[model samples]
Target: MPSTLFGFTITDHKKVFAIALPMILSNIAAPMLGLVDTAIIGHLPDAIYLSAVAIGAMVVSFIYLLAVFLRMATTGYIAQSFGADNLAEQRQHFNHGLTLAIGLGIAIAIASPWIIDFSLWVVQPDAALIPYASTYIGIRLWSAPAALTILIALGVLLGRQQSGRAMWLAIITNAVNVMMDLVLIIGLDLNVAGAAWASLIADYVTALVGIYWCAKALNWTPALLKIIPDKLSQYLNVNGNIFIRSLVLQLCMATMTGYAARYGSDIVAVNAVLMQFLMLISLGLDGIAYSVEALAGAAKGQQQPERIRYWCKLTLVWSCIFAVFYSLIFWLFGAQIIGLITDLPEIINKAENYLPWIILLPLVGHWSYWFDGVYIGLSLSKGMRNTMILAAGFGFLPLWWAGMPLQNHGLWLALSGFLLMRGLFQALWLRLRWRQVV
Candidate 1:
C-alpha cells in the first residue's frame, strides 16, 4: 500500500505521472513541428523567409488558439462525467464536442481570407515578406477543419485518462509533419508554401487517426450524434467563457509579434526563436497541467475536495521543480539552441542577446499554466476569463505601451511582465477561491 497525505497517496503521484509523462512527450513533440519549420526556412538566403513563416504561423496559431475552447471544454466536461461513472453523459459530451469542433473549423476555413488580411494588417510585416506569409496562410487555412477535429479528439482522450492514445496521436501527427516538411521544403524545393502543405496534410492525417481511435474507444455510433439543444446550449455556455479567455491571450501574443515586426526582420526572427523556447517551457509544464486538469476534474465529480487540494499542492511543487530545470537548461545551452534553429548569424546573435528573458520565463510563467489547468478542471471558466482579461487589459497593454521607447528590448520587457502578472493574479484568485473552486 502507498503512503497517504491529506488524501493524496504515493499512488496519486504515480497516477499523475502516468497521465503527465505521456502528455509531456506529446506536448514536446507538438513544438517540433515549429522547430523543424523554423530550421527549414531559417537556412534561406534572406532572413525575410524566416520572418514570413513566423508571421504566417503566428497568424494561423492565433486563429486556432481562439477556438481552443473546443479542447479545454471537452476535456473538463468529459473528465467530470468519467469520474462520475456516467457513460451516457461521456458519450453525450464527446458528441457535442466533436460537432462543435467540425462546425467551428468549417466556419474558420470560410473566414480565412478575412482573418489573414486582418492579421497581416495588425502584424504589419515587411512589404516584401507579405506575399510569402500570405501564401503560407492561404494553404494552411485549409487544414482548419482537420486540425480542430484533432483538438476535440485529443481532449476526449485526455478527459478519459487515455493518455497513451493521446500521446500516439501527437507523435504520429508531428512525425508525419516533420518528414513531410523535409520532403516538401527541402526535397521539393518549394520553400514556405511547401511547409504549409506539409502542415495541411499532417493535420488531416492526425484527424483521421484521432477520429478512428475515438470511435473505437467510445464504441461510437452514428445514431449517438443527434445533438440535443439543451446539452449544446450548456456546452456553448462553458466554451463561450473559455473562448473570450483564449482570445485575450492570443491578442497579447499577436500584439507582441506585431511589435517585434515593427523593429525589423532581424528582431522578428530572433523573437520567433525565443518564442519557441517559451513554447517548449509552456508545453513541458502543460504536461503536468493536463494531468491536473483530468485528475482535478474527476475529483470534483467525486466531490473529493481534499484530493483536489492535494493535487494542487503536488502540481505546484512539480511545476516549480520543472521551472528551475528549464531555466538552468536555457542558461547553460541557450547559444547552442539558437544556433540549431537558424544558420543566420545575425538572428543567432540577436537571440543570444535576449536569452536571459527566455531563461526567466519558466519561473515567471509556470504558475499561470498551473492555475489554468485547475480552473479548467473545475469548470471555472468565468473566473479564468476574468483573470486573463484583467491581466491583458490592465497589466500587459500598459506595460507594452510604456516600453515602446525601448524598441525590441521594451517589447520583451513588456512580454515578460505580462507573463509574470498573469501568474501572480491567477495565483491570488486561486488562493482566495480555493475552497469554492476545489
Candidate 2:
C-alpha cells in the first residue's frame, strides 16, 4: 500500500503507472492505427506499391537508427540534471541536444540520396520497383531534420517525466498521418508516394508540436549556452558506444531477415507477422523501462542509493506482471491474435506453430529492458554496448550457425537465447561494479 519494496518506501510506485499506462494504452491502439496503414496499402490494386513502401521504410529506419543517440543521451543527461535540480545543466543539455539533432538530421537529408540508391542497388529487388522505392525514399529523407528534432523533444519531455505530453505528441502525428493517408491515398490516388507524403507532413507537424512542448517544458533562457568541449567529449563517448550497439543490432536483424527469406515466401510472411507481435511487446515493456530511466535516474542524481534500488525493484515488479499478462494472452489466444493480421489458413497455421517462442520471449527478454533503464539512469552506456556486442557476436551468431539445419525454428532459438544473454551479462556487470558507477 505504501509502494514499499522490502522495507524501503518507493515514495512513488503509482507514478510508475502514471508514466507507463499512457504508453501501454498507446501500444494497444497503435496496432489498430498500423492496420489502417496496412489496409490502405492492401487495397491498392498494384502490389508493387506495398513492396516499394516497405523497402523504403526499412532502409530509412535502419539508417536513421544511427541518430538514436540524440534521444537516449538527452534522456540520460536531462533526467540526471532534473534530479540534481541543476536547471542550467538541463538547459545546456537541451540546447546542445537540439543543435546536434538538427545538424545530424540535415546531414542525412542532404547526403543520403546516394546512400539510399546504393543500398537499394545492392539489394536489387526488381527493375519495376526501383523508381517507386526511390521516389518514396527521396521524399521521406527531406523530413529527416524535422523527424530527428522531434526525437530530441520527446527525449527532453520524457526525461522531465512529461510522458503524457509525449504520448499526445505521438497521437497527434499519427492522427494527422492517417487523415493524410485518407486524403492523398484514397481520395487523390497518390498511391505509394501518398503513404510517404502522409508521414512527411505528419513529421513536420509533430515536429512543430514537439518544439512547442520542449520550449515550454524546458523553457529555454534568453541567452543560449554553449556546449563545453569536455562535456561534448563525454557525451559523444556515450553516444558513440550506443551507435555501436545499434549497428550490431540492426545487422543481426537484417541477417535474420535475409535467412528467413531463404526458407520460402510463407515463412518470410510468418516471420513478418510475428515481428509485429514482438514490436507490440517491446512497446508495452518500454513504458516501464522509461519509468525506470526517469525515477531511478533521479534517485541516482540525488545521491539516494536506497531510492535507486527501490525504484529498480518496483519497476521490475510491474514489468514482470505485464510480461506475464502478455505471455498468457499470446498463449491462450495466440491463434486468434494471429488471425487479426491475415485470414490465410496457411500463414495463420505457420505463425501459431512458432507462437510458443513469442510467449517465452518476454519472460526471458524482460530482464534486459529493465536493466537497460538502470544503466541509462547512471548514464553508463558502455556496459550496454559491450554486453550487446557479446550477445550478438557470442550468443546469437554461434547458436544461429549451429541451428542452421533447423532453419526458421533455429533462427527463433538463437534470437531468444541472444536476448537472454544480454540480460544476464548486464545483470552480472551491474552486480559486480555497481558501487563504482553509482
Candidate 3:
C-alpha cells in the first residue's frame, strides 16, 4: 500500500509508524536528560551552574560523537549482511564494530584531560562555571568506552529489526536517569556533579543491558571474532568515510557552540535551551532515517534498486509531513515549550528570540536528515563524507564568517544559514550522484 500524503495507507502506515514509534519515544526521552539537567540547574542557587553543565555536556557530546562511526558504519554493514542472509558475515560485522567502539572509547578516556583542557581553552568558560564544567566532563569522560560499545551493538540489533529491544533499553536508561537526577540534584543538592554522575551511571547500566541482549540476538562465537581479512578492510574503509563525515558534522556543531560561547554565559544558557529544542526535533526525525537506512541497505545488498527508491520515497514523504507538523507546533507553542524546560527569568526571555530559529529548523533541515539515512543504507560513505565536508567548510563557515560583524542576531542568522546551507548542499549532492535514479 502507498503512503498517503495526508492519510494513512493501511499497510505502509502501520509499517512506518511501527518503525518510528519506539525511536520517536526513545528520542524524546534522550533529550529530556539534558532538559532535566538544565531545568534543575536553572532553579538552583545560581545560573553559573546551569551554564557550566551546558558547556560540559557539549564537551561530552563532542568526544563520544567523534566515534559515531561505530554505529553508522555497523548499521549499514549489518543491514547488507542481513539482506544477503549471510549469518557469518553479519556476526563478523557486529563483532568488529563492537571491538572498534571499545578500543576507541578507551583511547578517548585516556586522552580526556587533554581534550577537556583544549575545549576549555576555546570556550574560556567563566571561572565560576569552570570548576563545575571540569567536575562534570572529568567524570563523564570515563564512560565513553562503555557508551560506544553499547551504541555499536545496538546499531547491529537495529539492523536486524530489533529496534524494540533498543527502544526498551533507552526507556529503562532514561527512567533511571530521571530518578537519579531528582535524588542527586534536588535531594542531595550535588548540582552539576550529580547530573553528570547520574548520566554516567545510567550509561553503564544501559551498556550492560545492551551487552546481554547483543549476545542473545547474535550468533556470537569464538570464530566470529576471528574477523574476515578483506571484509574487515571494507568495514574499515566504510567506517573511515563515515568517521570523516560525522567529524565534519560534529565540528559544525562544536563551532556553533564556540560562537555561542563568544556571546557570554547569558547567551550560552539561551543557546543551551535552544539546542535542547533543536535536538528533540533532530533526533525524532532521525528515526525515519534510521529505518530507511536499514531498508535501503537491505535492498542494495539484494541488488533490488527499485526497493531503494520505494523506501526513500516513503521515508521522505513521512519525514517531511512530520517536519511540517513540528514547525506548526513550535510556532504556536514556542514560549510555552521553553517555559516548561527552564526556570531562569532572563534566560527564558533570551530564549524567546531564538525560538524562531528552532521553529524553522525542521523545514530547512529535514532533507539532509533523511538523505543521510539513504546514503548510509546504500553504503555511499564517500558521497556522504564529501557532501558534509563541502557543506560545513565551504557553505556554512563562509556565510557564518561573513555575518560575524553583526554581533547578536549575526550568530543566530549564521546558524540558520548553516542549516540552510547543509540542506541545500545535501540536496544537490543527491541529485548529482543519483541523477538517473532520483
Candidate 4:
C-alpha cells in the first residue's frame, strides 16, 4: 500500500527529485554554454570582443526566449495528456508543437536580415564591435529551426517524465558546443564567427537526436500529422499569453543590457558576467519548476486538488532551500566566480562591486521562479500574463526609471525590484484565484 505524508504520497518526494535533478543538470548546460562563450571571447585581445559577443548573444537569446511558449505550452498539454492516459492526445500535442516550432524557426530565419539590422540599430554597439556582432548573428541565425525543434522535443520528453533523456540531449549538445568552441575558435582562429558556427552545428545535432528520441517515445503514425483546429486554437491561446509574458520579461533584460552598454564596455562586460550567475540560479530553480509542471499537471488532470497542493508545498520548500544554497555560494566564492569568466582586472573589479545584487538575487527572485512553475503547470497562462505585465509595467519600469540616475547601481535596484514584485504579484493573484488554479 502507498504511504502518505504532509498530504502527499511518500513517493512524491522521489517523483519530484527524479524529474528535477536531471532537469537541473540539463538546464545548467544552457548557462554553462553562455559562460563558455563569455570565457572564450573574454580571452581575446580586446574587451570589445566580449562586449560584442554579449550583445549579439543577448539579441539571439531574446529572440529564442520570446518563442519559449512553444516549449511551455507543449509541456503543459502533454503532461495533462499523460496523466489522463490519453496517449493519442500526447502524440498529437507533440506533432503540433513540432510543426509550430519548425514554422516559427523558419520564419525567424527568413526575417534574419531585418532582425540583424534592427537589433544592431537598437543596441548601437561601438563602431569597432559592430562587424563582429553582425558576423556572429548573421551566421548564428541560421540555426533557428534546429534550436526551436530541440525546444519542442525537450518539452515532449519532459512532459512525459522522461527528463533523463532530455538530460542526455542537453549533455550531448553542450559537449559538442564546447568542443567546437575550442576547435573552431582557438584551434582554427575563427574568432567570434567560430562560436556562432559551433552553436549552429550543435543545435542541429541536438535537434536530430531529440527528434529521434521523441519518435521512439511516441511511435510514429500518419494520424499524428492530422491537425485538430480546436486543439490548435487552445494551444495558440496558451502560447499567445506565454509569448506576451515572455516578451515583457525579455524587454526588461534587453533594456538592462542596453543601459549597461550606455555606461561603457566595462560595465557591459561586468553585467554580462553577473547575468551568468542569475542565469545559473534561474536554471536551477527552473528544474523544480519543470517538475512542478509535470506533477501538478498530472494532478490537475486527475482532478486531485490535494495532490496539487502537496506538490506546491513540497516544491516550494526545496526551491527555497536551493535559493539559500545559491546565495551562500555567491557570497563565499563571488570573486573566484568573476575571475573564471574574465581575466580583465577592470571587469572583475566592477563585477565584484555588483556581486551583492547577485547574492540577493536568489533570495529575492526564488518566489517568482516557483510561481512561474506553478502557473505553467496549472496552465494558468492568463494569470501569468497579467502578473508579468503588472510586474514589468508598474513594478519594473517606474523603479528602473527612478534608478536611472544611479547608473548601474540603479539598474540593479530596478532589476531586483522587478523580480521581487513579480513574485509578490503572482502570490497575490494566486490568492485571489486560489480555487480556480488549484
Better of 1 and 3 by TM-score: 1
lDDT by residue (1-438, candidate 4, tens digit) is: 688755557788789989999988877776577677668868978787778777788789878878888888888888778778888888889878888888888988899899999999987878898899998898878999999998898888888889999899888888888889899989998888888899899999999999889888888654568788888888889999999999899889878987887999889888888988987797779889998988888888778898788888998988998899999999999999989889999888888999889999999999999998888888889988999999998878998899988999999999999999999999999889989766
Q: Please tell me which predicted candidate would have the highest TM-score against the true structure.
A: 2
- Deviating ranges (above 4 Å) for candidate 1: 1-9, 33-56, 120-136, 178-197, 261-266, 335-355, 405-407
Poorest stretch of ten by lDDT in candidate 2: 2-11
- Candidate maximizing lDDT: 4
> At residue 195, what lDDT does model 4 achieve?
84
Residue by residue across 221-330, what tens digits does model 2's lDDT show?
Answer: 53664777777778778888888887887778878888999999999999988997788788879899889988888887788888788888888888898789889988
Q: How do all models score by TM-score? A: 0.86, 0.94, 0.85, 0.88
- lDDT at position 272, candidate 3: 78
Off by over 4 Å in 4: 1-10, 30-55, 126-132, 179-195, 262-266, 332-336, 339-355
Model 3: per-residue Cα lDDT at residue 268: 78
Ranking by TM-score: 2, 4, 1, 3
TM-score-superior candidate, 1 or 2: 2
lDDT of 3 by residue, 105-224 (tens): 888789888988888997788777888898889888888877898788778877776777878887777777778888999999999899888888888888888877877777575455
Structure candidate 2, residue pairs in collision = none
Pairwise TM-score winner, candidates 2 and 3? 2
Report the Cα lDDT for residue 108, model 1. 81
Pick out the ten consecutive residues of candidate 3 with the lowest summed lDDT: 1-10
lDDT for residue 347 in candidate 4, whole number 0-100: 88
Cα lDDT of candidate 2 equals 0.84
Please give the CA lDDT of all the candidate structures: 0.86, 0.84, 0.79, 0.87
